[model samples]
Target: MARCFDGNKLVIASHNKGKVREIGELLAPFGVETVSAGDLGLPEPIEDGLTFIANAEIKALAAAKAANLPALADDSGLEVDALDGDPGIYSARWAGPKKDFTVGMEKIHALIKDQDNMAANFTCALTLAWPDGHMESFEGKVFGTLTWPLRGDKGFGYDPMFIPNGHAVTFAEMEPADKHAMSHRADAFKQLIAACFGDNQ
Candidate 1:
């Protein structure tokens, strides 16, 4: 495993502030300097991939090539068993161009209101790409069920209604630190860090 970022500068391919902040917090301990796509003035890619891994790779590659530095990207969404994993990759668009997750959550809740299985989980795929074309991918998921009447004001996207397995509180109701400790993105990022920086502690 690659060990120690050693003050390496990397690009986080995302324009979302929430995502950028979460990623920055995850990478901070490594002494890595992070920059976002919005910081670099890079245009968001079409993200027309058929899978999360593909989309993550696309964004990572784009950022790596553009910034000539190592880059990381994540593609994540909620997958409902009752909905046939629908709004998987389309999670963002389900809220429309305005990125209003409230509407998306309402839509999802309505669609699954009558279903017996409200089981769902959040999935995250992370891709790291180098300017030389070297790349790696990792994935993680947090199994849980959905909830109605979205709770809490914290977290973004579908967090308000997501109740992880074995937990009674929604992600939106949890602190950022608490959420990061068990989130799908956190799981994937832990694998990424392990892959990039082995057990140095």
Candidate 2:
């Protein structure tokens, strides 16, 4: 059986402003107080894991230990089929020190220039960990294709360059509620809710 989150306050183990905000909103419905790692003066641990799940667990465990509280972490990235998932785990690193997704997107576009297959997808791995080192993890993905000249300015990271499978607009073009409705993170959250929060569980 999966572990459960019985705590009233949870730490969101991430320093990314966009990610922190999105996750805070997601946790609001549960009525749990959410604090961020950045807000708590917690250092971001190195994300050297080979997979999203591993990385999420690393961050979650680090925060849980540091704060002595239950914590949640998400590791998400964009993967292009043509690139053979070239920046998969290194998605954040591709943005460089300044975390500029514009430069990262340009690099991807340049590498796949003249290529027809622009298939891509977003993957998210979420881990919830307790102070005792016990944990539960979940993953989610939203399939989409690459778009050039990127559209919209709402979302952060590679959002503007990705056109989700069923939508004409990129994620950056959609409203926050719209994006959250079908986001990779949301998909993962569903599994998490079922595992950790559901009455049936």
Candidate 3:
């Protein structure tokens, strides 16, 4: 059995405001108070891991130790099949030091414009780590195709151009409630909640 989250306070181990906001919204129902690492002035840990899960764990574990509290960290990115799953873990880096998605999106579009397959998917790996080094991890994926002329500005990152299966609109075009219903993060959260917070529900 996985270890449950027994504490009321949890640290969201991320510096990205958008990611912190989205995660905060998800935890709202449980009445779990969340404080971001950014807010706490916790230094961002180097994500040297090769896989999403590893990266998530690195962040979560670091925060847990630093804060002496349980922490949740999420690592996610886009993978394009035509590009050999490129920019998977480097999704954020592609935007350069400024973390600009527009530049990253444009680079991706340029590379695969002539390719036949625009197949892409968003993958999320969520890790919850306790101060004692105990941890639980889950992964989720939402497949979609890449589109040109980025459509919406509602969502952060590559959401403006990726349309999930069975959806005609891009992620950035959808409302938060709508996107939350079928996002890679949501999928991972389902498993995390089921395993770690089932009794709280």
Candidate 4:
């Protein structure tokens, strides 16, 4: 069985600053030394997978193979039930190459216009890969409804528009600690930490 993260060096296989920051915070308690893909000058790999899990695994594997060390990767996106789960894997590209989520949010809001049911959710899939091709994966989701005109300015991406279930404020309005505690990424990370650490606590 693998040991807990402890204080070992680990690579966060992502170039996005937002994602890297989130993952860094999540790994803080484990005393893990986190490194981003940008730090290593690693190139982003093609994510041609059909599912979040597939994409996450591909990224983790690529990073691990390239660095010859353990790597962690996550693929997450906003999934609108009303849109037939559209923007699932293409969430990043929905706004084109500029990674502008404003256009993507607008598109989603437009699609659900005048609809009574505006249910949606955020899904996250995380993967940890080793240099020997060994790997593990976990998934999490936070259900919520869509909101209009957006709100808050604390978070990036679609955070301004997504109001999590049972909450009055959108993710963008919430503090990082609060959102991290119940976020889809956090949920998935909980599973990963448990699996890796087991009953060692």
Tell me the tens digit of each residue's lDDT in model 3 across 14-96: 99999999999999999899999999999999999999999999999999999999999999999999999989999999988
The number of clashing residue pairs in model 3 is: 0
- lDDT (C-alpha, whole model) for all candidates: 0.89, 0.93, 0.96, 0.90
lDDT, candidate 1, 89-156, per-residue tens: 99999988899999999999999999999999999999988888878899999999999988988898
Candidates 1 and 2, the one with greater TM-score: 2
Candidate 3 vs candidate 4: the lDDT winner is 3
Write the number of the candidate with greater lDDT, choosing between 1 and 3.
3
Q: On a 0 to 1 TM-score scale, where does candidate 4 land against the true structure?
A: 0.95
Off by over 4 Å in 3: none
**Deviation in angstroms for 67 in model 4?**
1.1
Q: Which residue pairs does candidate 1 place in steric collision?
A: none
Clashes of each: 0, 0, 0, 0
User: Order the candidates by lDDT, highest first — what do you get?
Assistant: 3, 2, 4, 1
Error of 1 at 128 (Å): 0.9
On residues 69-136, what C-alpha lDDT tens digit does candidate 4 reach at each position?
89999999999888899888889888678888899999888988888988889999999998889898
Indicate which candidate wins on lDDT: 3
In candidate 3, where is summed lDDT lowest over 10 consecutive residues?
1-10
| Model 2 root-mean-square deviation | 1.3
